[model samples]
Target: MSDSKKADQKKAIVFLCDGTEEMEFTITVDVLRRAKVDVTVVGVNIAKEFALCSRGVKITPDEKFSESLSSGNYDAVVIPGGNGTASILGDHEGAKKLILEFYESKKIVAFICAGTLVAEKAGIPHKHTVTSYPAFKSELEKVYNYSEDRVVVDENVITSRGPGTTFLFALTIVEKLLNVKTVNSLKNEMLTCSSL
Candidate 1:
């Protein structure tokens, strides 16, 4: 590939990590980075080591939230679900501000399971179609008027149920950001469920 083409192909994906689900965070990062997308794990705290997932997995963050993350630096932001992650996201002022800014900029913002609550709390409209963890249905129904389903893709936002839906959620984002052909190829190579 030409130099300019290579540069244009580069995309930075940030995962806002605060003890997210081990499966959701790792699977999405592993899949996207395997596709050669630049993936960064941003720590919501000041620690330089790693955050322990609910499942006892450890993830080292590339940068801290104290560092500014302008939308220009990344093509998308992903939030993985874990009660700790969701509660931190909901309570952290800076994290909430950044999420809202990213949404307002119309960049790709994705959340899975309880992570959708972070987006919803950021005031992004759920509109006609949306979904979340079945347990969150009561809260979601109270906040956003939308039809619930197994997975919900509204414009640039993608959401799914939980760890069981992690692969589908990642593939959906890949399909949306990359392409259906690429998504299919990845699925075939990995023997993952086809998103048809």
Candidate 2:
């Protein structure tokens, strides 16, 4: 494809990983790549090897956070749930800053399970509906001031519960970033899975 055609066709998605939930990160990566989105897995630390997920699976990142941030290009930022990943993202000044900047720019920001903690810590208002692991609801409720009963999508931010909702969360992000038609097609292709 030519530069203009590539630019017009590509939609960039960055997945920040540091011990993320294996299924959440892998499922999102797999589904988005299947849809032909330009997806990049960004390493949040100095380790060059694949990061180990909560389930003991290792995933190789596509690029380092330093490099991707320096490039200053991406259409969306996705965070996968894993307490370790969430804690690292919550404390990383650079990641938090970029997340806030992306949100301010009105780009899609998605988090699932414990990943929502990073968003809450980054100051995404609780008033913006959100859902996460039941154990973490109080943390989000305190910040956003709204108690969400189920999976919630507020504007460009999407949040879901735990492993049970991973597929739906991934599809929801796809639906938001691309379109409902693409999401429907993907769902139809993966007929075993239910719709969002």
Q: Each candidate: RMSD to true structure?
A: 2.0, 2.1
- Scored by lDDT, model 1 comes in at 0.76
Which lDDT values do the candidates have, in the order given? 0.76, 0.77
Which stretches of model 2 miss by more than 4 angstroms?
46-48, 67-72, 145-150
Model 2, CA-based lDDT: 0.77
Which residue runs does candidate 1 get wrong by more than 4 Å?
Answer: 10-12, 16-18, 46-48, 126-128
What TM-score goes with each of the models? 0.90, 0.90
Worst 10 residues of 2 by lDDT: 66-75
TM-score, prediction 1 = 0.90
Error of 1 at 30 (Å): 1.0
On residues 9-100, what C-alpha lDDT tens digit does candidate 1 reach at each position?
63654555546788988888877876767787777852447887787787788777764667676777888898878888878877777777
In model 2, what is the error at residue 32, expressed in angstroms?
1.2
- Give the TM-score (vs. native) of candidate 2: 0.90
Per residue, candidate 2 scores C-alpha lDDT tens digits across 1-196 of 6787767553555555657888878888877876767887887873557787787787888777762473246677888888877988898888888788778888888888899999977877656878888889877787774445446788988888888787787787778777888888888888835636
Residue 89 lDDT (model 2): 87
